[model samples]
Target: MAGYEYVSPEQLAGFDKYKYSAVDTNPLSLYIMHPFWNTIVKVFPTWLAPNLITFSGFLLVVFNFLLMAYFDPDFYASAPGHKHVPDWVWIVVGILNFIAYTLDGVDGKQARRTNSSTPLGELFDHGLDSWSCVYFVVTVYSIFGRGSTGVSVFVLYLLLWVVLFSFILSHWEKYNTGILFLPWGYDISQVTISFVYIVTAVVGVEAWYEPFLFNFLYRDLFTTMIIAWILWSPSDILEIHPRVFYFMVGTAFANITCQLIVCQMSSTRCPTLNWLLVPLFLVVLAVNSGIASSIENGLLYTLAAAFTVAHVHYGVRVVKQLSNHFQIYPFSLKKPNSD
Candidate 1:
């Protein structure tokens, strides 16, 4: 009943009992991630509305795609022998991807704090994400394929998967039955471990046997981490699934270990961690432009075929009401009739 409150615990399936356990969240990111900048976003006042954050994310994604296309791999080069095209193009593409992901993290925070967490906001957030995936895969694979039949298959299938997910997610939200590891509590260790792994992947120093990041952070791998632990949390509810329960536990442990690692690995030596993601440029780039070979092309074709089938099946299930997703959040939105 206080400050634009909406329905909480809007039950979809059995996720009504979603609890705030140790594994699913971290406390810090829940708050700090919101756009509380000191007069930085000039056009709109900081407090105008958090809705702009959502728009900002979309713009960034578009910018990234455009940058990639303009710098087409046919024109850009990365490393000495790894030459592709224009070096600045790749650099800009990577930087833009980094910016998009970072913005992805901020919008939610701004929404909740500003009490602007509307049904439209949720829809826009998820919709943009799906589109971003679409644009990214299509643009990159198309070029990486260099007009090969194999590349066509992979791009086609990967896109089918994103489309299916987006459709189902919208319905899931409409019915208020999204899968629940829990609700909007930010899990600290889960994110920290992800960042650590990404960092490890970038450093050219030494590649560990099992991807040192993974071996070093078993908790992140095992934990069923989500954005469920940062905000309103309690310890009373029992988990409906054993596997999910354990994942949460592992995430908690991993979060603790990551904090320690940050302390041990920082240049300032103050145990602080930075969350921006320019370092992931190569990974996304890889997804965009895979290497060309007969075997690689064959695999792309197969993946495309399988995903297409999966997309068809998901549509069938939704149409027949054979699916019943359990939603963890108790909040409800008045889904607008699109018809």
Candidate 2:
């Protein structure tokens, strides 16, 4: 098995094998988007590599970032005012983001259908997704205007950190329990982002800056809703179904607390292969916070470019290492083992 840590084929085939599989609790994805993605998956040629599909979708997001940079070079500026980029730019980015979201769903199906599924595929897909989450938030900040004060910057940083934490928590859950449970929040976020795009297209990006109810900015209201969901959903107060609330709120707290305890009790038992990588995110959070507060356009672009290159490099290294250890050529457009 080429030094690979292999699980037994019988174990893989058992009824509980995929019990922890990535479960999407989103109604829109379950009822509407998945069928559409299945159809799209069917259209892809068998010879087309699934990893390529995944990477291409991520590239579209990168293109979205570039488009923002090109259209509004002052987007990251420390200046207090918002950029006057055309309304169509927001519309274009919105459409591109939706396409990226759709393709993100399609890649896994393409992998399974073509028999090319591998751990590498899962890692690659998710690793890119982790980075894309940050990109999406940064884009939103640019549109709404970067926060100039320390408090505002902290709020933005905290929002970004929580989103990333939720993602990291999922991986930690899988590491501990061997199941990947996708929360309802993920689905709701996708739909909300899509809705944001449509709204931006209709009303223009400037509308987000206007005061809504009680003199709060529309963007502030949206942020408040997200923050409220993060804090309040775990309680028994919401009208959500019990099982769903448990899945969303209870699971998140458990994953976080469990991982923290593990890390505290035994260094070797940490769920992640690279524990240092986790802290690097905090460093990024701080750096980005400073950049947002100072409105340093040059540092912002430099950091973005650096992160893109470094992330891709790290992703390739992970895939290569996993491929070597598992003896599975994930880059090959071939079918995976049935077992």
Top TM-score model: 2
TM-score per candidate, in order? 0.37, 0.63
TM-score of 1: 0.37
Flag regions of model 2 displaced more than 4 Å.
1-20, 73-83, 147-151, 209-268, 271-311, 326-329, 334-339
Task: Estimate, for each residue in 119-195, the C-alpha lDDT of model 2 and write its tens digit.
Answer: 55766677667667666665554555444421233344455556656776676676666666787787677667766
In candidate 1, stretches whose alpha carbon ends up further than 4 angstroms from where it belongs are: 1-45, 73-83, 139-156, 159-339
RMSD values for the candidates in order, in angstroms, are 18.4, 11.5
lDDT of predicted model 2: 0.55
- lDDT of every predicted structure (CA atoms): 0.34, 0.55
lDDT of 1 by residue, 136-178 (tens): 4433332233221122332233333343333333333333333
Alpha-carbon error at 327 in model 1, in Å?
28
| Leading candidate by lDDT | 2
